[model samples]
Target: GPGAPAWAYAARRHWAALSPPLTGWMGHADPFAFAPEWQPAPGVRRLLVGTPPILAMTALAAGVASFDGIDIAAAEAKSAALVSVFAALVAARCPGVGVDAPPQPRHGAQLVVRHPHGRRVMAALIECGVIGDFRPPDRMRFGFPALYTRFVDLWDAVDVLAGVIDTGAWQDARFDRLGKVS
Candidate 1:
């Protein structure tokens, strides 16, 4: 969340037609003048709402700076390769689990898989230090960020998943209790 800041972009031609739904003082052309009526600032400045979160902005700047030397194309290629390998592994070793992502180049940096006991399985994986998230009904989502995730991590994760499924480790009652954030 620190790195992922909310933003918007529009073509120069569309600027006049755009209006922020929630107008705040910061979006006024002359906020200090305290005019009787609302006068929006020019361009994207009109989209601003309220005071900026300085600390969050600082964190966002730092997060963005962290990617200064990264080659986005290379990162994307690595992500595709990692996702392909992970999907293949899941298809081969994990019998009951179904790879939910589309074929290579069509999918994103994450891989989703479906299982009957997806929630419990995800919890078990988390316990084993393999962090993943479970969506409602039957999907487990795993993000393979090219900047950090390694190829061996996918192999190890799959191995642990296979073991968990084959041994019925997800049957544990501790995994059934849902937390607020989960």
Candidate 2:
């Protein structure tokens, strides 16, 4: 649509947004190429994104002997499977709850559930010793790390959550009350 602005096009091309009337200095080139000397002092390094093959190639090119946090191909695949299972379980057993996205373990599975008392639901879960991040109004995100999480953990979490909902424990005024970020 002609009504769309120029920044929309920039976003589609995965370029950084800039004000109207783009300048030549707006990320047109790789900054690293322009300033090779800006490489950080050698130390332990990690990258949260990029394909395994690409990350491996970069590590080899940089002569990195060891790196932490980057998942091996097999491990990532396995973790993704685990995340799928957890998401599926949550979706099946919990009403008004659904997985946030395709079940992937990039950072573990994120489950999204809708509750009128979203904050209270989250607070109750936390009190039950099941920790998950929450957003205002109504968004609860639970992460199941493949490396440390067990199938039983998922089963137990769902059991606890179902109890909370069924018992209406989340309706407690104390739970409904906001806390710092909650």
Best by lDDT: 1
- Tens-digit lDDT track of model 2 for 1-182: 22222222333333233333322222323333555333321121111111235555665656544435557775666567766776777778878765566434445445566666678889999888988767866778777555677778889988988889888899887786645653
- The parts of candidate 1 lying over 4 Å away from their true place are 1-5, 10-21
Off by over 4 Å in 2: 1-71, 102-109
**Candidate 2, TM-score vs. the true structure?**
0.55
What is model 1's C-alpha RMSD?
2.8
Residue pairs in steric clash, candidate 1?
Answer: none
Q: What are the models' TM-scores?
A: 0.84, 0.55
Q: Each candidate's lDDT (Cα)? A: 0.88, 0.61
lDDT of 1: 0.88
Model 1 agreement with the true structure over 1-182: per-residue lDDT tens digits: 43334677778888777788878798899989999988999988888767767888888899889899999999999999999999999999999999897767888899899999999999898889888888989999999999988999999999999999999999999989555655
